[model samples]
Target chain A: MSIRQIIDWAIEDSRSQMTGTIVSPFYEYSDYGGHWVWACDVDLGENLGVLRCVPVAANNRELIYAEQGRAVTLSRLNNGKWVITGLAKSLNSTVHYIFMSFTDDTYQVLRKQLRGYIIRPLTYGELGTLVVPYGYGVLPYGAQGKFDAEGNFLEIVETY
Target chain B: MRNISAALENIILGGGTRRPDYKVYAWDPAEATISEVVSANGILDDPAPVDLTPYVSDVSWSDRQLTFALVDPAGLFHPDFGELRHCLKDGAILRLLEGDETVPEVDWAITFTGQVHGQIGWKQSRSTGQITSRLTVFGRGETQAYKRRKITSQEYTVGTDIGIALYDICKTFLGLTGKEMRIPFTLGRQFKHKTNQLAQVTPWDGVCSLLKVVCYQPFFDGEGKLSYVNKSLHRPAARLFEDGDRIKELEVPECSQDTVNKVTVTFLDSQLERVDGPYQKLGQAQVTTGFFSMHETLETWWSEDRKQRADGTSMKVIKSVNSGILPVGSEHYTQLDEFHGQIEVEISVWVPILATVMIAEYLAAAFIPDDVIVLGFGASEGITIPVGRIIQAQAMIGILLIMMSIGSAQYEVWGTPYDFAYLEKKSVAVEDGLDYWLENNLDIKNDFIGTHDQADIIAMTELSWQKCLSMPRKVSVADDPRLEVGDIIGLPDGRKLVISALSKNIKRGEIPTLLIEGCKVLTA
Candidate 1:
């Protein structure tokens, strides 16, 4: 089979062997509410895999509106970006996982497992308080960062 | 409160019915004022706060900048938008105001002021599609251009009033002829023979060194005038901070390293000397540099001896590095009373006199003498060592030994210190009598010598000021043209801070950032 076909079959099969919780500010490691159970399939290359997870409403409230792709970036959401360990899924469907380095896409992700949502780069000076995952790093740190009217932290996701 | 510069007021007010939304003024080199060119009041925008450095301590060597992005839709079609390159020149000053008033109030003051240094340029509005310019200007501190211009007189002696000499040097030597020169009027300093021999050092360095001596702070005013005030002697800028201005404070710990308790100003003596050579070949000529410590060498030879400059200042010329070349054929006749009186040899060292002494001492210590004790590597080497001529072979043997050692090293020897002094009315540098720096800790030497021991006190005070009160805080001011960079702002708690940098984005209706340094000591 061709490389692209192999990738497509593996993803369509929905055979997820590995599972972990999405790093989120509002959810604990085990809580199912806002935590996303992701299955990442490593590619032939080292640490190169696709991440797949399902979108769920946090506390079963606000609408889940997003289009998760390879690189999502927004000037306002400059606080937290999960090194989403996959492509994003809509509220109706399950999110598929494809892993690469943490690359910035447009700002359009609002994933929930059971309790809270996972976010992008934290604000400047807010890093010391964050409990970071092993491979995750924060970007966009400065007092002059822009924000939307709602005061949601803006973020840029990238590997250091 | 202090009033704004007239030139600045004229452009900001005269532009149109409204004062310039935000101006980026450059200090004029010809006139002690901001240029009318770069000074434009575009529809000012809220300057983003991220670009400003919160506070700057090393502004001395860095640019004091005012940077912002603005829209200029009319381009050259508008009468208000003149050629901004002149205004954005190296020395341009920036003054920012808040309101769009036709006739502004003193209270509606300039919120920002700095000199122009650079630009990143024209963007157009998406809606109106009008083009705008992003201009950046620096402060007056950038006037120090390291271009080498010769100071005609080798030495300038500062009499009772050093101000006149400072004014002359700034006006003439640095080519700041048209610029206003505001110097301290009080007369007490006796700074003698400031160094001009240093390659690439501008006359502005001389000005700083001079101010360093008198315990003065050198700065250019908003008017672009070069002025320095001995605050204790003259009144400082007005206390402008009042209530109502919002402020943020960040307390910085004391930094002792920036402060100095003492200073020493070192310079060469103006006296000149000509070295005679055995052969009139240019290769046989010796060179002397300002770094040679004459006083150290002199004191080693002449114990308890003191030599003074013509202006009565202590001797500092270690040795004058000579670069003069002697033409051939003229050597025989230039050789006065050839074969008899005395003979000369030349060395290729920076200090010819010291080379002569070192050669004599090296030979006497190595080959001949038993009871001869040489001090300080023979500081008194040329001083009557083999006992002055004392027949022929004694002096000739020393000369021959020097000539023999030619392959090992180079030496350019003249008659003696006495011979050179006789030919040219110069004092023999026996020892540097000013040993005040030596008496103190090796590291704690004063670069500026005060009238009394005031240099130490002044250095310490300046250090304390730099250390304790330099905590800088950055904030975004929305609008109101009355405030400028130098304007002081008093916090609600009554603490004062001096604005070091004020950046405004003319197209965005708000001030993006203000770098306000801690001015704990409120000045008049």
Candidate 2:
């Protein structure tokens, strides 16, 4: 596709990702209190896709106010790699994690497990990075690493 | 019981006997016939009758009282004459007869009458050689007394009568009169060795003592022999000697050389000088030349030297510092005496920059974020932002920050640089130093262009562009003739476009406002 077309698709996809269906684990504490999980597919029209889930109150029909977690979507570009973007809200803190992305790899999963968040301008092919959304006081620390083929384990290289 | 005259006569006669056979008799008035008969015989009759009646009847002949009642010529008898008669011996001159009557005239009897003048006759006889027995008596003693010669001149010295007066005058003038004047005539010796003894004496005693030693010479008129001179002669002479001549000649050897004590007194043409030396005023005896010397030294030390003035008084210059006077040479800390034009410009541009940097350092530690870097831009075009733009940025941040912090709300800005550049151009610096900085560092055309893009971009958009376009611009009409009604404006290209608005919409209040406008670029 042309660059304009690509930009138009990215814009449309960003909008859909912002407003599409969400999914999360269904939970019920009583007859009057229960949450319904919904999901939407973010597709870059090739092999790259992201499944997003949000918890909606069954009684109120509103999205669940999740704390310390986020909903995200991953898309693949023409280069056959994936970029991720999402909205995150951290409860009881001033930090708000904004849209960010990285490639489709176990490195992203390792970053999600270790750092609990992600950010844009993903660098160092196997080492996933994140934006901390820190204010004047908050600092983020992590070690540089690589993901094995199984993508279940990470190999530490350096720390910063 | 003894008569004084008789006693006196006896004492006088005790030394020598020179009798002229004188007798004192009384005249008998009853014996006048006998006195007549005696006078016929060539005898000198009684000069006056003596009264014998009272004496013959009253006296006893056994006392040989040939009482002759005599009367003095003043008609009073001597009071001692009766006592003299009582002291006469018994059987002495036992006769009772009148003055002219002698014993009864008998054969070969001598007659004793008044005033018998005896003529001594010479007889030449055959048995004896020639005898010259005539008495040659010159004259009888006269009844009047003798007069004495007078004195004319005399001499006196120190404490004699005259000298005492001189000493008194000296003491009165010199406060030394009552004392013996214990002054030294020689260096080591007193003129009068007996001054202590003399000081004890009264004026008279001192005078007498002085007189006993002094040679008194008297000038006298030679008349009678010295033996016959009476007391009157010597007494008056001594008085004159005391009063005049002696005092005039009196000399005090101790005071002879005392010139200060010398007082000359004149009587007509005669002048007398006090014979004292080294005298001063009475109260001033203790004063000396050394005292005056000390006074002069103190005056010299206490008195400051005065500079002579034209009016004859003196004054001194008082040095004072006048900061208003321009300092000469290198000591001046100001450029008041140097080239005046551009120094103010240079100083004004740099001073605030340094001051702001200092203030920024202080603020950065406190309220400002540590990451908020303070760019120390120099004066070069590439390095330093124009001062007008900087000031505008600061004002914008201050306003926006106040609104955000106090109102608890966000604010939006239309992206444009025109407003800020307009504000920078129109805002007048009210102070000298700031005005100088604005004039030198801020080029109006360049500042207008540079801040114009930023102001236009900020004014065109409705987004929260306050942070991206930090500089503030106040809306104002463009004074430049080159700028027109429509313009396309942008900030430096590297920065993002925070917002945009059409200049026409801004003027009509459709968009917020276009604070500044950039250069017009038209495309057909």
> Among these predicted structures, which one has the highest TM-score?
1
What is model 1's C-alpha RMSD?
32.8
> What local lDDT does model 1 show for residue B212?
61
lDDT of 2 by residue, B295-373 (tens): 1100101012211111111111121111112111111111121111001001123323444554464444344332333
Among incorrect, acceptable, medium and high, the docking class of model 2 is incorrect
Model 1 fnat?
0.00
Candidate 1 chain A lDDT trough over 10 residues, lowest sum: A90-99
Tens-digit lDDT string for candidate 1 (A1-160): 3453455456634433222222212221322455554221111111222222322323422222111211111111123222232211111111111111111111111221111122223433455433354222443342122223244444432221
Model 1 chain B weakest lDDT span, ten residues long: B422-431
* Fnat (0 to 1) per candidate: 0.00, 0.00
Candidate 2: tens digits of C-alpha lDDT, residues A1-160: 3453456456645543221111222232222235333322221211122233322323432232221112323334454333233322111101111111212110011111111111111133323323234332222222223333233334342211
TM-score of 1: 0.36
**Model 1, C-alpha of A100: deviation from truth (Å):** 61
lDDT of 2 at B262: 10
